[model samples]
Target: MSTTKTYRIILSGGGTGGHIYPAIAIANELKQRFPDAKFLFVGAKDRMEMDKVPQAGYEIEGLWISGIQRELTLKNLSFPFKLISSLFNARKIINRFKPDVVIGTGGFASGPLLQVATSKGIPSLIQEQNSYPGITNKLLSKKANKICVAYDGLERFFPENKIIKTGNPVRQGLLDIDTKRTQAQTFFELDKDKKTLFVLGGSLGARRINELIEKELDFIIGHNMQIIWQCGKLYFDQYKIYNNTKHVQVHAFVNNMDYAYAASDIVISRAGASSVSELCIVGKPVIFIPSPNVAEDHQTKNAMAIVNEKAALLIHESDLEVDFENNFGQLMASAEKQNELSQNIKKLALVNATKQIADEVEKLLKK
Candidate 1:
């Protein structure tokens, strides 16, 4: 009798769409390569992944996990307890699943799961989506078999030998959006005569971006510009009133992101890793406003990577109040500048990220 084992793989990452979507994208690529492979996902209990994973047609297990708050909060006190519980839980899942390979995209759940998988001598990899590695990825780097990174110079945070620059995995639909513009404008009900600006602040939303747009609504319209604003779930109630306004559509979430990217002439977004990658692929003239709330101020670093390449323009959140109008106006009036930014950012697009990362996983299985 011929015998070939069906490969089993474990993927853990969540807490935000930035982490969750990349994990899902990687899993999708892996499924395509190993048609009969058994895939399992581990995410923090109560996180969006618990709901998102099942929707993606993958079975998932949740760890009782969350991150330690930077401030002195009561949640920080329970962090140690949560860590211990998650490690134990991860071990149980590892033992039961006996995965041939384990992968962590980056989140609290990934921390315990990868740590346990590495300790058990299973092959494991981590996908770091930022220019600066997060605390979880940095700590887990010592034992990781491979570290797939989105940016260069992560050797400062991870082992030089394990690091591979695979870039960030973005939705494949964005790879060819030039043909979608007319269809996208029709989809969003946007006037083609007016310039369209896409405002994205991650899945949870950005308070400063929403506020700046709210204050500058008249300014935007006066310049013959329309906006498709993704206000995020948290701020939807506060900003949804603008949905009734002319030339403005405020959404809690943008489900049709491919269409949205196609419809945009300019993009004003937070510098989250996934957003940056998608924007690069969409090849739009972009203005980045990095969130100050992230650990190590990494969003700024992520934005700078592109900005330094002259691929995009950045406005620190603190500078928005003073520079929003002049900077936005100058970009709006200058077609030459817009084309330069679009072409430059497109040059940085890494369309094969998902495939490359999947290839890395396949290598581990062979080893």
Candidate 2:
């Protein structure tokens, strides 16, 4: 028998935790399976990944690139230059690392890294976390050795033959939240019996969703419902003192997300691809407030994919003012509706996506 070969893999993604965390989860699995494997990450320079990757105990290189500024600014003129620099840098990194395979999660840097990796005859894979594919993933797919997707109907974006609906790989830790529902109540000092609503605005938080909750905090309480609100870091300090009573609570971030998800009867969140993927597993009756700020309005497209299937409800940013509280009230009153959504969205859950992604990575190494 031949000896097993050690694999060196390069992982690329950044600009958001939605992309970074899944990359980490996939890397974590590879570490467990191939303890001898080497891994490197590439992310946009001066972005969150510079801090996050080191924190995750991985070595990452930075590309001097950014998204094209939607509003015309002097920085927008640097797009072509940045693209050229990133291409040169990606080639340098790939040649030095000599990885057997490359994996791209959605981010500003993934475009160049994966494109070069594919050109070099290395097997490249992309994990598209959204229901509607992002433009980077769409372009990368033409050369991707395999495309793993979370949502169906993605054939419109990638070659159908290369696509695998593996869902988003959620950290196993989140799924194993300490089964302490009452403990979560105590953790947040919440009323154990009152209906709990968890408001999430993606990994960072949604300003519009947070504003809506702030506007309707009293009405939410007056209706005899309790809340565990994650106001995101930006608005955290402004609202952290919102502990008017046991029925309402505010947090900058929920360290124990599994607890927050477990303690809640309802969730109000942005429709980020990862949020939608994890929510499908959490099985909460969710109100998706899709942000219009993202590229391609991907957040709304993600939410609509589920809403159109009747697996969830959508509240557009423009409609939040008029529809949020009223629709939320109706959802809270109807356990049947909540249960139906909960069951239906769970149907889309692929809990084994992490292992599956890793398995595919391992298979490529042998070939």
C-alpha TM-score for every candidate = 0.97, 0.91
Report the C-alpha displacement of residue 54, candidate 2, in angstroms. 3.2
lDDT of 1 by residue, 1-367 (tens): 9977699999999988899889999999999988899999999998888988898899999999899888889988898999999999999999999999999998889999999999999999999999887777888999999999888888888889998899998876777789899999999998999999999999889999999999999998898999999998889999999989999999998878899999999999999999999899999999999999988898999999899999999999889889999999999889999999999999998899999999999999989
Candidate 2 backbone collisions, by pair = none
Name the lDDT value of residue 130 in candidate 2.
Answer: 82
Model 1: what TM-score?
0.97
Superposed model 1: Cα runs more than 4 Å off? none
CA lDDT scores, all candidates in order = 0.92, 0.85
Question: Looking at model 1, which ten-residue stretch has the lowest summed lDDT?
Answer: 170-179
Best by lDDT: 1
